[model samples]
Target: MKKFNITVNGNQYEVEVEEIKDSSTSAPRIQHQAPVAAPQPSAPTAPKVEAKKPVVTNGAGSVKAPMPGTINDIKVTEGQAVKAGEVLVILEAMKMENEIMSPADGIVKQIAVAKGASVSSGDVLVVVQ
Candidate 1:
């Protein structure tokens, strides 16, 4: 028996798993054994998992950073059309390259971190409308 649909942090659990058979059988078997309480399945109305916030669209643009980074240069590509500051990538963090501009001129639509790719602070490098 095995059934598992679990999601933790947004709560959803229906789990049932049973596998126990080792058996050596020394003495006489069959006396009387009754102790079993493990079956809990009643919670599924569905409609909870909603934590989506990545849609940077006011003309959808983003080249975020400001801290925690290591994506040294990725100037633009993917359907490129950006221009509202327009540097678009180059983040090194402590050694400091940190340019990452362009927040609103549109049409790149998605880049989402990948040059050396190690971003953290705000982290969503390039999306541009």
Candidate 2:
């Protein structure tokens, strides 16, 4: 026999369980036990709110990969004029193609990653200014 303390819906209970090993046809017995003392109420706590840090870049107008992936395609070349939200690179991660977009309207100043190159999260893909 084993004894245990259990809580259900904030109510406390004491329980006893017995193991049956006999192969003969039989039903396990159950006994009702007295309820334990109610637990003390705890002070409620405020939910924790975490502040998100802005993405850090190597330089102004630098675009980086958000996750580890292969550079599937390069949509903009160096010296090309681009607008904010322009897709500059197609990154293949977890079998999905993710478009790397320009963060602001600018001219493509440099290509930091080449097509078919593997990159990690935060790796610079292009620099525009």
lDDT of each: 0.67, 0.86
lDDT score, candidate 1: 0.67
How many steric clashes between backbone atoms does each model show? 3, 0
Return the TM-score for each candidate structure: 0.29, 0.55
lDDT of 2 by residue, 37-111 (tens): 877869877889864333345667888888999999999989999987778889999999987788778899999
**Candidate 1 residues 30-107, lDDT tens each?**
332233344456985766885433323233355567678699879888898876666777789888685666756767
Lowest lDDT 10-mer window, candidate 2? Answer: 50-59
Backbone clashes, candidate 1: 3
Off by over 4 Å in 1: 1-39, 43-47, 55-60, 66-77, 80-106, 109-113, 120-124
In candidate 1, how many Å is residue 63 off?
2.9
TM-score, predicted candidate 2 vs. hidden true structure = 0.55
- Number of the top candidate by TM-score? 2
Residue 45 deviation, candidate 1, in Å?
Answer: 5.1
Clashing pairs in 1: 57-60, 59-129, 60-129
Q: How well does model 2 score by local distance difference test?
A: 0.86
Misplaced by over 4 Å in model 2 are 1-58
